[model samples]
Target: MMYKFLFWLWLFIWCVQPKQSIAQTLESTSQEFLIRTISQVDFKQLIEKIKTTHPLIAPSIEMVRCIAPTLSVWCVRYTNRATLPQFLTALHAFPAVTDIQTNHLLTKPRGRLISDPLYTQQWQLVNDNINQNTLDIDIDAEEAWQINTGGYTTHQDTIVVAVIDEGVLDSHPDLTHNIWRNTHEIPDNGIDDDQNGWIDDVLGWNFKTNTNNVNNDGIGHWHGTPVAGIIGAEGNNGIGISGVNWRIKLMSLVKGQDEASIIAAYDYILTMRKKYNESGGKQGAFVVVAHASWGVDSLKAADAPLWCAIYDELGKVGVLSVAATTNNNTNVDTEGDMPTTCTSNYLVTVTNTNNFDEKITGAGYGKQSIDLAAPGFNSFTTLNTGTYGVFGGTSAAAPYVSGAIALLYAMPANRLMDSVKAAPAQTALRLKQCILAGVDPVAGLQAFTVSGGRLNLYGSIQQLSAYYGLHQSASILGSLNAYPNPIKEHLFLKVSLTGATRLTIQITNLSGKTIKSRQLGTLPQGIHRIRLEMAHLPNGIYLCVVQGSAGRQVIKLIKK
Candidate 1:
């Protein structure tokens, strides 16, 4: 009876052990490979040919999907570790394959983490002389917030900003209200509901793990949640701290530290923006700006031209990208730095500044490369633990710029919204101009940065308001109108005022050369029209700038 029992036990053990070992073996051997094919190659046919021709790797390898379908880039998963070289060789033999590269791991750049004794207040936004902070040395966020708190455009279109970093803790109390949700997508249904190629991407995409779980709780990934909080943490709810914008939508794009992963992440952003533009705000997300807080130092544009070129593509589609300079306190222009060095007007590069309104010792600076500085040292922000903490670095600085852009979009300006609808590309560049031109000149940054100043949120908002003929209050320059835009002989001007005020009209050429100027003395609270002779002016584009006692406006005119 004992011998019979022993035999039965041996048989039971033998039956289940191989199944467990096989599962472990498959998990251990799985590897990801990114492949770029020529434009004309048929993806499905090529994938099948590779599988059938290389029989040894047939059962172990599978095509994941085309990440950048427009670019013919595909990611493949191979579980036959022992036959990886054979599979690669077979792929190389195909004439359609352009390039093959394995995924490269990357680590986030570390900023100087100095603990401040007083972390209770966000002096970076107001700077009320706390902790020896210089009075009024902050971003003037209070004044800007009073003008617009940010959530949707004046046209009532929801504003969304993409945070391309590790990932965001979307469920955190302070962020839950502002987190972006794909209403078309059904959660955890094991199906591609929207058919955007990603499965169950209700929140956002995770390029690192190729999954929809963008809420990363990994050790170093703590960077993303804080960054997101700095851009759009919910405000006035009496909970935690408020971000630059209290009510803007934030999208998470989780990425690994690799060129391919970064490109894939951006491609996802490009895809969404393109869809929005094509669908007339019906199907896709309206991501106006994207923020990246991580970059590699000493990397040049020559080495990553594709990455550099992506900025231009984004700009063409009316999306601006903001990036952080390396925190090495080095001259990025000479030593070289990615992204910041990319000469795309659509790209805004930011360096770190302290509460004293001075550049930090460990932050990067370049007179021509770095655009501006922001309060990045010891600023209070949300943490991944569903709590508040002091988050700083150039990482913190970049979001201030992004939030400013989103805030500008939220302004209730009819002309501003009209311009965006008419010429999105030009409007994007104009926003960049507002940011660079409205900076508060800082003596410490004068010789080290392009703007030679720190960010002034109020000033930037004012610049946008002036450019688009918008005022904080309706009492001054209520409306401005210029007709017969392509004037052949006469250009008519109409001004609407809420109260009596003097008005000045200045017409300048595209090169900013003043072509004409007129002073229309004080007028009562009503609409008035005036005509100007334009028969002698050469054929070209011009700016009709109108200024009043309390506000200003600009109109575009074309002379025929």
Candidate 2:
């Protein structure tokens, strides 16, 4: 009896132990599944999905850094006469030349000069007859006007815009004036001049080398000079191309393509902002904008945390972080990309458009994420050695907007305030309006971007100017409110005027068409309530203009 009982107990123990081992293995397998399936999922996409499904997420503006530096050169040539065969043969014979093509003058020499070796030419033609004036281009003119009209000749503001990518050609004539100087630390002193954790950041810091070698090596992908040219090329210098905002100081925080270096560069920008603000210097407004023109592919969404954190920190300090919308052509709404994908409210995400007002085929798009489009493809700008090239990508587009922001900041008291107040928010809103108000209603907002409707710089400037005027007056008026802002029902207007005056109310769509207008009788001083019935209006965003003796104010109202 004892032997039989022992055998049964041993068998039971063996059965129970194997089952327990199998269960443990299954639990271990489940844990591994969690790491790969759940933990490894794209955080940006998950956050974006939540924001879309859940309004509480309130995904705000995010500055994306997406443009990669290109080592290739671009060149163009002009002939004494129209001779395609001779030109092609000459171009092909050139040692540095790689590709060549002809323009409309193939039949006759009357047409405009054409770009040869389109992709990798280091030199380009400057037709003396063909309005080589940069002002002829809409972007160049807009930038010039933004600076000249504002009367901001001196660099008194001294705001720093950090370029985090390849190093800058520190010696470039056009960029030398605006390059940041570490005043605290002396240059070439072999000491940590400013003692800001850097040995020598004379012009700007380079994290890639962990030193102050800001020189453009002409190789190794330090394309910082071109990026700098976009942000603050010295204007009216009679040399090279013009920058967007020539007055602002530019700081270079160089970083490699690695994630760690990128994070270090971001931290460096924040640190400088903090140190500058703490120093009690006249230029208290330090590092107002950061330009990042590179992005990771959508498949690498899991690795966007560092960029997202940098973007978030920039927003916290009132720094307007600008990022490229990417040249990947992926739907940013669905897939995730760093810097741009990180949904931070203070960031201004920019995509690329071509000179013809059409979205570049490769420019990324999204209704929820992408803020606006700017000139990108076949655009000409300053290159490395006091030269210029025609490069394409959202990278170029990002700088155009960056320069525009600088110009807006330079406007007069009223214009400056108006521009600064609404530039960030309006950038996002205006982009949405431009995209939504497409030529084809069927394709809706999506088709309008790339289907031949490029970025309208002239129109954007006009809109920004008008918006600035409206916002400035509204600030002074005070105590004015519009209910049902995303109007799904009858809209309500409440106003508190300081003095007795007649108020005129007008509602118009983006097309400048007056949808509704009314003259309100004189109202007694203090708060008064007025209502506009818009239940019959179609579903779209409308701008409500209120004109009084004070000034005109415009507010966006959506009719759902």
Computed on alpha carbons, the lDDT of every model, listed in order, comes to 0.78, 0.55
lDDT of 2 by residue, 523-544 (tens): 6444455778887986554688
After superposition, candidate 1 runs with Cα above 4 Å error: 1-120, 218-220, 471-560
Q: Kindly report which residue stretches of model 2 are placed more than 4 angstroms away from their true locations once superposed.
A: 1-137, 143-155, 280-285, 299-303, 415-560
lDDT of 2 at 396: 77
Candidate with the greatest TM-score versus the true structure: 1
Error of 2 at 556 (Å): 40
Summing lDDT over every window of 10 consecutive residues in candidate 1, give the lowest-scoring window.
Answer: 107-116
The stretch of ten residues in a row with the least summed lDDT in candidate 2 is: 28-37
The C-alpha TM-scores of every prediction are: 0.64, 0.53
Q: For candidate 1, what is the lDDT?
A: 0.78
TM-score, cand. 2 vs. native: 0.53
